[model samples]
Target: MKFGVQYYPEHWPRDRWAVDAKMMQRAGVNVVRMGEFAWSAYEPKEGALDFTWMEEAIALLSSHGIRTILCTCSRTPPPWLYQKHPGIVNCALNGNTQPTDERYRVGLAHGEFIAEAQRIDGAVIRHFAGNKHIVGWQVDNEIGASNDCFCPRCREKFQEHLRQKYSTPGALNEAWGSHFWSYNIEDFSEVPTPHKRAQPLVEYRRFMSGLNVEFSRWRADLIRELDPGKLVTTNYQNIHAQHTDCHALGRTVDVNGMNHYPARTPELAIDYYRGARGEVWCLEQHTRLQHHDTPAGRMRLWAWMAIAHGATGIVYFRWRQCRWGQEQFGDGLLPHSGEENRFYGDLSRIGAEIKHLGDMLAPTRPRAKAAIVFSYESRWSFEASGFDRGLGPVTEAVDFHKALSRRLTAIDAMDPRENLSAYRLVIAPRLWMVDQRIADNLRSFVGQGGTLCLTTASGVVDEYSKSFDTPRPGRLQDLAGVTVSDLAFDKALRLPLASDVIPDLDGEEGSLLADEVHPTGATVIATHAAGWRKGSPAITMHTVGKGRVVYVGVRLSPEAVQTLTNWLCETTGFPKPFELPNGVSACERACDDYTLLFFINYRDDPQNVQVGEGWIDAFTGESVAVAEVPANDLRILRSGK
Candidate 1:
């Protein structure tokens, strides 16, 4: 329930600290995140280290009842440190990248960078370890974002990782399947750089992602060792980014945190970042992205949307726009002139509403009976193969999530290896890379009477980026009950489903891929309607021990996906949440005492919903029968207990 802004006392003059504090206090901001990117300001010289000014800023905010979410500023080391030490920054295959002013230019596995980061971060932790006003410790500023270092040291570390996984060159070549084209290596040191081959490229990506997690965990473990009581987390970039696996990062930290920008992000990103643990802080909630003037009242609506998806905190990126940095045009609550605008008014209203409703909303989170499984390995495999150009795994996953959310408001988007026993209908979209564990997980879910749906381009390869010598879908071929005779490459097929089975999906347009599925002891649900592919199976389903599995042979549009979701719900008798009109969202969060509903209108016109009885406005305590939400606005209602 923390609400605040990211403040930088070092970025501004010393005299304006009290004014910002007063303004934040008036707006009901209970927290301010600072000191994330101010490494040089703290230690301008090698022997000269000063923290008295930061202490003063903290005290000023604490006097106004504002706490701090201090970040360990290791993402960007002081420029002097880079100048003093050479070969600490990242280097591409060509040469070392310049401009040390940018953040995360250093390699993760570099010894020099790791040593200096630990030194500086350990000092920061000890300095404010006992500060009562400091509520949490953010480990780093979005680990693995804008990070794709391929330096010699990093490459050596990757080679070491490969060496550990496979003891010798023969084992490495066997797993990578690089015997063709005479790419064999005599030793681990002889392994070439990882861009040309699929398996090597995928392994490289896996190595780098693990390195990012390792670096973050180093800081996280350091925080716990030094300061044990406070929560520790690093802000995750948008879920669509394939660099760092959020699932692993979520498990490593105490609570998950995300950088949420609603203008360009989908609702699935918010729910996904709020991982299975269901505790997330929007560490960098967007007010206005660069050059994109968000519509009026949308800021408050976006904040509510985050809360609706189980974000426990909302901290805007900045209180005021920077006047002179690279992001000078970035928008915030107050303009660069330090004057309040419409966005500030929106923030003021939101703060008051949260002040009234945060406690009631704090204990509640989104509960789901439907889930979608995502795999980072599959995304990397897709990237390495280079065939998934127009429709990637992320696109299909996001589209499927949006469709599922239309029918079920609280659908869980999870990793491939997480627990699937909680969901009745689980959808796996374009699971192109299937490992043994993932296959076993899906089998267990379906064997226990949970209905599973898998889309096209699924199970094309095994864990090591090698095509399965057996039938497609690798290990799950029996569970899925279908064999792919041929898969069309990047074809846009026409689907004509059985009208008696699901009438709504008759005129479906399937795109991206088409698989010619031959059912074995299963029923064909749909077929291609056009010439040259007429009567070919486009979708198939089978009943396996007490459950059903559906295989979609082509990519479905969002509307068609929704139709398929509704048909699944009807066929399996899965309990679905109450529905709302298009462009209107109603997400429910409940406890034993009462149930709270967050209503958001994303369209230009207002939306109205009828509650049968016994609903009161959570903010005003007034009984409401029909909730009226204006254009780009939101409402909160509490059910009578």
Candidate 2:
């Protein structure tokens, strides 16, 4: 696997590049990601550009036998460019223009801004594209803005987008459900982002995602035009809910990369990685002492967990910790003194381990048997409005999905259009907003010998962000073999309220979004604790054409959900979770004639494990009846002849 670090040229002196690169090479690091926020250094003026500094930096790394992944350096616009072209500043939805304080503050729709970015991008690519030591290019650092742009250019573009989508103002009005408050429009320009309580929030949310997707596509095209041969990607924030369509974004890039921080548990990071397809990399990993908590295992454990989840490349955010800059972010392998620190020791150990594994993990990919439907549009719409005026179903469902994914072999978030027939189980947890065609496709899947699992608050809204007129749980009610009488709002219930039932509580009682069920030849598996409708069902199951559909009505704790899911997984023929020590994780991948098993132990304690017949350790190159794995270690076992 490729190991690297993301470096800021300004933070370290140009003279130190050669020494840093050599140290990294000695430590088993093979790649370096350069220049995400160096726009000011590269472009000192409007049309004039400079590559002298970058050329020296690249050559220094090449001399050390380290590969470089050059960035376009457009994420943070040069201060001079923003000053000259004020229109490039992004305008917020609240009618406020973003000030020149933070990075990534440029308006994506500004034509002149894009033209200058393209110019600088072409120059950078032309300089480094032919370098033998350069392996790839990163298009943009983190290409997302929190605020929706309300600039004139963005407004005009949104109108054109709506016209292309709806074809007419009447159709747009009907789709957006804009007739509630005597709102009528004759032109696309009449559409405005919902600010207060006046408009349907769902429509505005959809528009934000669509606009971001278009911007991402535009940025990807610019980079591809410059250099198509080298691998290209943009860093994504894993588990972030704002930019929902990352799977769609992944399609536009050569590799999928993520910046992950797992404050809760290592499993959360693994779960998020499993949700994306293609080769994955941790572009920015944390490693330093903290004021709040002790550095987690000196950073080695974190790196191992990422590798366990199939990270092809691992890179830290900094080569040298900053002492007098905004990046005093408390996480660097090297301290400000640039001496070998404790964290550096941890990194060196992990790097040695990777070298030992060598080709075994370098070209391997994760194999799985399950898929989860995760859509940015659906999640944003569900969070837009309506749900007892508090946290919505989508938020709760994401937590639940992450919990369940922790136990599975490989979990991926996929668009419904992606072929899911290969997966033994397909789950749509609280899919509130769905297109009609996709809904029909899901229904057809269950009809044709596929197992589907859905949850409450699903199918309640249609493609245009409008609620169905018939009843709650709209188009999927029939397919789910249940009907809704009323949405039981603000209801909290305890799981396994009866004896002989395992309560689904992590620690406390959880809330349910909606409650109603009229089964049609379906079995009621569980029910609510108490209410006027005390005996109402909370879980149901129905057998369709050649498969079955399971509907969970309320949120359950991870333990409870796993209990139920384990049963289903066994029934559907998914591989059983291999029993391992506390910090040990094992996963298997197979080729036509061979099977490779990855065994990773993230703990500091040694472990003794049985070596099944026909397997040999890839790292130690030893054949034995049984073996003991050392502390903080990883092993790959290939099938023996």
Candidate 3:
């Protein structure tokens, strides 16, 4: 329940430090994250380094009872270092070296660059190793926000990584299935740069993602060695961010952190990052409007939404907007005039509320009965193949997650390889790429009394992006009890569904992609009601050991997805609490002592909810049978001993 803001003492004049600190303290901000982007300010020249200003700033903030989330500036090195090591520039996909004017232009595998980065990072950590005001370390500012380079050195390193992984050239060839276009390699070095091939492109993505993970781990380990008392973390961009695998990167830090923009990003992103690692933080929570105008109270509501999704701390992006740079128009709590506005008023109100809530919400966690599996490999593979451009894996996953949100059930969105034994229901959307390991995991989940639902375009390729010689779903056909004969790709196909099986899904329209599913041992729950493929199986269900599996062969409408999800919840006996009205959402976090419910009204009009007698509002500490929450507002209630 900590509230904070991103601050940059180096960006402003020396005299403004105490002023900003006093203002933030009055606003109830307990923390300030700084220095992840101030490399040039710290070291103006190549061999010249000074940290006196940073120390002075830290001391000033500490006097006001504000801690610091210090950050390593390896992401953006000073200009002198780049000029000294000109070869460290990244090689773009077009084979030209990217200029070093912008940040993140240095190649990850560059030897000289890595040495210098490590030196600077070690020096920075050693300087503040025992500082009491420094509470945590942010490894880097959005590590791998840009794609990695494809230089010869990186290629050589990737080949070495493959050699270390495969042990032999023959194994590498088999794993990548490089024999399709005479691309088979006799030596590990023979693997060419990524082209139009799916396997190589997917492997390159994995390799680049690994480079990011290794880089973050390097800095995190350095921090641990120098400052073991402080926590280390880095913010992930989003779920569809292809530059780095966040789930893999989460392992390098003590806590998972995310840059959240609820106006543009989905609720699934918050839940995904929350589940990626145990405790999460909104490192760069949105304060100002981006792309769209944020309503008066929506900003604070979004902050609470992050907390409801299990974020331990919420740090707004910035205290004031910059008057210069590319993001000059990017708004913050204070406008360019450095005066408070409506947004600052909203922040002040929420800050007081959070102060009142205090540490009472710290021990609770989001107890979820359903989970959605999201795979980066599958998403990368799908994007590489360019089979269906409009059908994104992230879109499908978010759609299902939104449906679950509409039903007032908190979901754990994470990688498919994560543990699925904790939940009663699991949904995997567009799992286009499946390996034997993932297949076994899903099978085990279904076999152990858990209900599993898989959407269209699932299991179309193996681990190496090669189509299975057998059925379409690769190793999941037997477990799913269905095989695909032909895939319908017509965008205009609004095929009707059967009415009797699920009455709510009756006559629902299906579009985009549809598979002609031939069931082997599964029961055909729904079939096409129109066109030439009339009465064909569009959705099927199979009963396994102690669980059940449902295969959705067509992309159904949003209404249909919700209906199917509701039916699945009912069939699985997972509770779907608090039927929310339109434009309203609710999520719950609980412990043995009590359950806290967060009700948010996203609509422009106020909404009312009927609560039981035992429920008490956390903010107001009032017991009531009914609660009226204003538009773009939120309420937290504690119930059940």
Candidate 4:
């Protein structure tokens, strides 16, 4: 596997390059990612160039046998570019243009913005195209921003995108339910951003996701045009709120990369990697000591967790801690003094292990028995407009996904094009925006002996932002075998599973969104505990064709959700959980000749697992008489005999 680290050349003096490179080689770090936010230094003027410093840094790293992944530095446009072309500035829904203070303040669709990005990307690739040391290129850094664009250029492009999708103004009006307020439009340009008060969520969400996808395509195209051989990717922050669809973005890139902060649990690191489809590179791994009572081996544990989930590379955000800067990120392998720290020792140990593992930890795609249907459009819609309640289905969906990730072998957030037939169980959590075709597909999956799990606040809206006039569950009501009579927007209630199928389900409160369910032809598995709608079905199951469809009417805690998800996985005959201690994680992938298992011990204390005879530990080149692990360690075990 190739190991790389993200670094800022401008932050460290040129003189320190040799020292840093040497240290990296000693630690077995091979690749270094450079220049994501170096626009100011790269292009000082509108049509000027500066590569003297970057060239030297690249050369110094190459001489040390380290490869480089050059970034286009388009994430933050240079102040000169933004000042010269004010049109590139992103305008929020409130009619406010972003200030120069923030990094991602430029609109993606602005013509000048696209032109400037292309120029910079072309220049960087052309300069280093022949350089053997350059391995890949990162297109941008976290493309999606939270706010909606209300600028005239974005507004126009959004209308055009909508027109191409919906076809006519009348069709658009009908889909968005514009007649509710006698708000009918004659042209596409009449469409407006849904405000906090206005509830035209479906259209707004579709527009936002569409915009992001277009931007991703634009950036990927620019980079590919310059260097086709160099793998191109954009780092994605693993959060639902950012509205960046990594799954959709993954289709545009050669490889997938994600930034993770796994302070919550070691399991979260594994989950994030699985979500990104397992071909991942960690852009940022926190490795510093902080005030919070974070566990002692937390960093090591999370790092190993990532490796187990198919990380071909391991890299930290900062090699040296920052002394004075706006970021001043405290986490680094090396302390601010440029001396070896405790974290550095741990990193070196892990790096040595990876080097020893060598080909054993090569890129191995996951073999998933389950799939999760995640839609960027659905997330966009929920954030755009909805019942103004504190707890909503969107938040619940993200929570449920995190919960499911803890137990599943491979859990992927997938687009519609992905094959669902291979999955024994398919889950669609909080899929609010369900068109007829998608609804039909899910029904077919269940009909064809595949388990289907659908959660609450689903099938509420259509593609056009209009609620289904019939009932709450809308298009999926019949397939779910339940008719949602009315939705209690933000009501709180507790419900427990009647059957002792899974442990610990007593008095778990369901908040955010709840519905009054009236089962049409489904078996009631659970009921609500309070309110006038008490005793109403909260969980229902229906046998469809040779399979089954389970509908959850309310959200549950992470633990409770995991219990249910595990039950489904077990029922479908998925693989057993990997054998590892609490702080240790393991993931396995099998090829034609060999089966590789990634084992990571993420604890301060050493962890020991009894591996059956005939498996060799790839890291230490040791033939294990009995399986055991050391503190803060990672290993890959390959078996071919």
> What is the C-alpha local distance difference test score of each model?
0.83, 0.68, 0.85, 0.69
* RMSD after CA superposition, every candidate: 1.7, 3.3, 1.6, 3.4
Task: Give candidate 1's root-mean-square deviation (CA, Å).
Answer: 1.7
* Tens-digit per-residue lDDT, 1-641, candidate 2: 87878776667787777778878888888888988777788877776777788777877887877788887777588788877888888887777888777777776667887777767766777766667777887767766655357777787777777788789988877876667786678998887656643234555555655655565666567556756677777777655546536666676677777775554334444444445463577887766544455443546666666765677788877777778645675666787888887777777777888888756666665566666675666766666654432244444445545544545645655666566666667787777776777778788788777888887777777777677887656887777888777655555545442212334322323255545777876787666656555566777788888878888777655555666676567777765555567666665555456656766666778876675677777665667445566776656677775
lDDT of 1 by residue, 1-641 (tens): 99999998997898899999988888889999999887788789875777788888998999999999999887788878888886788877575574677777888888888888888888888888888888898988888876677777777888899899989899888887767888888888888778668999889988888978988888888788878899998899886778887778777789899999988888888877875666689999988766775778888888888898888889998899988767788757788888778888888888898898878987888887788887888888877887754466678778878777666657778788899888888888888999999999999999999999998878899889888888876687888898886777655455554434666878877875778787876688877776677777777898999888999988777788888888887777865555577899888777778888888998999888876689998878899889998888888899875
Worst 10 residues of 3 by lDDT: 573-582
Better of 2 and 3 by lDDT: 3
User: Against the correct fold, how does model 2 do in TM-score?
Assistant: 0.90
Question: What TM-scores do the predictions have?
Answer: 0.97, 0.90, 0.97, 0.88
Instruction: Give one digit per residue, the lDDT tens place, for model 3 in 50-101.
Output: 9999999999998998899999987788878878988888898877998776
Model 1 lDDT on a 0 to 1 scale:
0.83
Query: What is the Å distance of residue 525 in model 3 from its true position?
Result: 0.8
Clashes of each: 0, 1, 0, 2
Q: Report the number of the highest-lDDT candidate.
A: 3
Q: Which window of ten consecutive residues has the lowest lDDT sum in model 2?
A: 497-506
Over 4 Å off in model 2, which ranges?
A: 196-203, 264-276, 288-290, 294-298, 387-407, 495-510, 580-584, 598-614, 621-641
Query: Clashing residue pairs, candidate 2?
Result: 244-376
Model 3: lDDT of residue 527: 86
Once superposed on the true structure, which residue ranges of model 4 sit more than 4 Å away at CA? 146-148, 197-202, 264-278, 289-297, 387-408, 500-512, 528-535, 575-586, 596-640
Model 4, 1-641: lDDT tens digits are 66756777888888888888988888878889888888888877866788889988988988888888887777588788877888888887778898877777877778888788777877876787767778887766766764356787777887787788879988877766677777788998887765652334455555665566676677677667756777877777665444565666777887777675676333333444345355677776667545465455566666666766666666677777778755665566676788876666666776776776666556456666666775666665555655543344445555655555545645655654356777778788788777777887887788789988888888877765467788867888888888887665554344444333343444655665677788888888766666665677777888878898888887766766766776777777776665567766566665567766666666777777656766776655566644566776656676736
